[model samples]
Target: MNAYTLLPFIVLIAAMFLMTRSAKKKQQQAANMRNEMQPGSGVRTIGGMYATVKEVNEDTVLLDAGPGVDLLFAKNAIGAVLTDEEYNRIVHGIEHDLKSDAGLVPDDASSLTESDESDGSAAATADDKIDLGKKDSAEHGADAIQAAEDKAAAAEAKAEDESKKTDGDSDAK
Candidate 1:
């Protein structure tokens, strides 16, 4: 009824408007991320299930869920990139051979895979510096894999040296 009373109402309305605007911005960001997604990228859905993108169309994606099964979902339904366990599970369950089935693999798959793989190989070759252990390999594991191989080789050489030393001690005794 008075100006002071109207002031509180106006403030409340402004706060609600700001909150909605923030939500819309976040939604737009997520949509943009999904639109840019290509095949071979790991994705999680709004329902929390993770899948590897088998194909991407204008408004939908064909996701491999395993056991010869694939799921078709709207582009906007994807929540985010999947973690290591999720990607492995999805890949392991795929019944159709992605490499063999030319139709199954999306056109973008090769380029995306090549780009991601090249980046990884380049990074690995550039540095034996990083540990690249299990934790560092959540998204893609190729770099971590090379690191693991190096670690294993180092361990084996150490073990062999220890065995030879023990053999020499026994012979001397």
Candidate 2:
């Protein structure tokens, strides 16, 4: 009957209203995305299957799952649509990372090699050969872990030395 009693109910109603409004906005955005689906677009399904849009129906979509594979799915099953740039990045980024990890230089950097500048010949040096394919993934991972541990140990030793110096300074003071 007073402001004190009505305050909790008012706060609860405001929270519920805000939540409903957010849900409605999300639903509208999803509807807009679905309506904008066109053929040749890349989409990932809710089941985590990546496919290309082959055709679009009122409530269903035809997807190409690569290599002459085609399947139909509900329109609502699509999770997100990818742009052309995103699709190319996903496909080629892994290859680029793998090449870099294998100790190979990019084709454009001519000063790093002497075999051929115009032909993009990557003549492997002794260091590159030693680091190339001599070890398995497990061995490489172990080496990386060991290097990190050595750096951490060095840092800890330095920190301890600084702390001891500080303590000695305080004692002298």
Candidate 3:
């Protein structure tokens, strides 16, 4: 066999080895995490159910889903072991000592919009601008509905005229 043919096989074997190695490492980590689960520890199952670990057996776990709700789950079914803060925030709706959001970035692009001082020229000519199918709002709500109805009526009338013209042309032909 040529070296070129062996190269592909070598690459395939290397890839499979690396993938299996990582998968084994992940399994080991999961096993360690599952073994570390103690009573009162918060856990999320593979099915996305959040609960508190009430008991840890050899291959099974007793989870306290809620008050008077004990659910038995396999150790492999536990997806994540959550921190107290995360568990409390999700389950009990308790917020930890969070810093003020003033320093954080805004969630939307509203802050990026041009301010009045940046572009007042557009605002000055806004009233004189022709409509470009922009919906009216606030005080123009009724006017917007009326405009929409008028526009639809005009479209229907135009379609009727076109149909009439087409029929007349057909007769001529």
After superposition, the stretches of candidate 3 with alpha carbons farther than 4 Å from their true spots are 101-173
TM-score of every model?
0.46, 0.57, 0.57
For 5-73, candidate 3 gives per-residue lDDT tens digits of 899999999999999999999999999999999999999999999999999999999999988999999
| Per-residue accuracy of model 1 over 87-109 as CA lDDT, tens digit each | 66565664444566665546564
Provide the global lDDT of candidate 2 against the true structure.
0.83
Clashes of each: 2, 0, 0
In model 1, where do residues sit more than 4 Å from their true spots? Answer: 83-173
What is the clash tally of candidate 2? Answer: 0
Taking all chains together, the TM-score of candidate 1 against the true structure is 0.46
lDDT of each: 0.79, 0.83, 0.89
- Ranking according to lDDT, highest score first: 3, 2, 1
- Output the better candidate (1/2) by lDDT: 2
lDDT of 2 by residue, 1-173 (tens): 89999999999999999999999999899889988999998888899988889999999999999888999999999988888767656644534345456676566865554665455445545236454557776758988889999999999999999877755567777
Which residue pairs in candidate 1 collide?
66-93, 67-93
Best by lDDT: 3
